[model samples]
Target: MEYDYHCTVCRGHLRIGNKLVFSAKTRDNKYGLIFLSPELGDYTTEHHPDFDIQEGEEYLFYCPICHARLNHTENEKLVRIFMVDEKGAEYEIFFSGIAGEKCTYRMRDKEKEELGPDSEKYRQYFDLPDEYRKYL
Candidate 1:
């Protein structure tokens, strides 16, 4: 399944080839370009060796196009982006920004789909409202 990723702020295309590139700032203030797999549930990442990222460390992500911060308002540990399928239906995509954390959520309307082993770690933030839960 192919999906296109975009920056939520500027709606700029983020998927380049097989990677979604973003500007990242480490907790210690180190900055670098981070390449992440476009595949949902795939946590593989590529970056310069000099741009060291430590596991369990939270990093700030930004859009390379508009340079807008991608951190989700509900949870800073997760980065928000827009994902459009071939049908042109757009959905909100949220993924972990903490190194080595594998959690992702794809949400549309009041529906949601979780992907990754650590997805439950942030499940509470993505849960539908009590009124909507009855329909689920």
Candidate 2:
């Protein structure tokens, strides 16, 4: 699917992708998983949402710092992104920034740990935007 997403800060073309699965731990130490596509935008559901990920569909998940393309198959376990509520009391893990930011928490003991590679814990540290942050 094609979209017209642009970065609000730089007006650069915001890359699009199919979010196959969003698995992370909640603030209460519970695991959660969500599956959806960007084409559906904000109307995602718990099962078989309006958006679908076709076989062999290419999705781009980029780095927040340099905006680089990430390789999902090889770097899935390395990177992660989390979203924290306004109260700072609730949070969730959304994306693992494996090939991009170099999370140290999740990928501890690895050669290059950005923030330890923990998805939920990383969200607690980074001040991510609400919309994009929720998908990770």
| TM-scores, each model vs. reference | 0.92, 0.23
Q: Against the unseen true structure, what C-alpha lDDT does each candidate score? A: 0.90, 0.34
Give the lDDT of residue 86 in candidate 2.
37
Clashes of 1: 0
Candidate 2: lDDT of 68?
A: 43
lDDT of 2 by residue, 6-94 (tens): 32223343332544343333223433344434332233424333333332232344443345433233334322333223353222223
* lDDT string, candidate 1, 1-136, tens digits: 7899999989999999999999999878999999999999989999999999899999999999999999876568889999999999999999999999998999899689999999998787667565553332
Runs off by more than 4 Å, candidate 1? 128-136
Residues forming the 10-long window of minimal summed lDDT in candidate 2: 106-115
Q: What would you estimate as the lDDT of candidate 1?
A: 0.90
The best candidate by TM-score is: 1
Model 2's TM-score against the true structure: 0.23
